[model samples]
Target: MSATPAPNASQSDAFAQLLRGSLLPTAVVGLGCVVVGLFSSPKAAWSAAVGAVIVLFFFSLTLLVMKRTADLAPTTTMMVVMATYTVKVLVLGVAMFALRDVSWASGYAIGVSITVCAVVWLFFEMRAYKRLRIFAYDPDGAASLETPAPKHDAAPTDREPRDEP
Candidate 1:
């Protein structure tokens, strides 16, 4: 069987829109945090930048991975997601442990920036998802992700009805 193309940020697909919405706000807030952190101290600035980058990378990777796995079996998707989560947690733990004694990074700045950026990203993503017309359960059938949805005004079908019947 031929494989479908993986979803990307370049597409006008639902996940792509959500990805854009999430990334934009996270980036803006991340920058703001960095600027504010700079005003506080160099250490704080570095911490804030690191935190923002962490949040952006993790969230984007999750979304993109999910998009890539959209066509996979549910069990396979779950396994992939679990593996991803485990790896992320382990990486984060190791990084934090390695950086615990860094003289130029403030934990407070990092924590605050991570929280703010994650919140902003999640909020915008939720908003974008809410605005999409994706139907989870259609009585007719499920819609295809690789193709545009059928337009209502395209043409009349036999199902219209018999006037005398």
Candidate 2:
């Protein structure tokens, strides 16, 4: 069978920008955790992988929500975010209860791995978000978010009158 390559995504896209910033660091930590776990025991290795997968999947969902709401009003976006979080929390609680007795994925290893992945992911995601262009002044906006301001003296007429006689 012949192998065909998948379509390429642009790095300039919002989703891609956040994905690169967050996924790289999370994946690195996950890989390291899994590698360390492998040396400890087979069960540890699988647990680490499982834990990492759970956190990564949840994070990806958050990013997807952001992308979908990028053009929405700030209030709307926050509402969507809160809704998504509530759903995830409910799902996680049920999943945790279901996995309470599972021995294949040790609780300790899973907890440690999940904790590390989550912290690393949050740190990287914060960094990435800070780097995103969000110019609030210009009508065109985000296009100039990272662009340097034009060098020019402010026009006197640009200022509004403070008082009238």
Which 10-residue window of candidate 1 scores lowest in summed lDDT? 3-12
Per-residue lDDT of model 1, residues 70-156, tens digit only = 678899989898888777667655655666567778877877887788789879989988888666776465454447766898776
- The alpha-carbon deviation from the true structure for residue 165 of candidate 1, after best TM-score superposition, in angstroms, is 53
Clashing residue pairs in all predictions, respectively, total: 0, 0
Give stretches of model 1 more than 4 Å off: 1-12, 89-100, 139-165
Worst 10 residues of 2 by lDDT: 3-12
Q: What is the C-alpha local distance difference test score of each model?
A: 0.80, 0.79
Candidate 1 TM-score, C-alpha based:
0.68
How many clashes does the backbone of model 2 have? 0
RMSD to truth, every model? 11.6, 9.1
Give the total clashing residue pairs for model 1. Answer: 0
Instruction: Give the TM-scores of the predictions, in the order they appear.
Output: 0.68, 0.68
| lDDT agreement of model 1 with the native | 0.80
Give the distance in Å from residue 43's predicted Cα in candidate 1 to where it truly belongs.
2.1
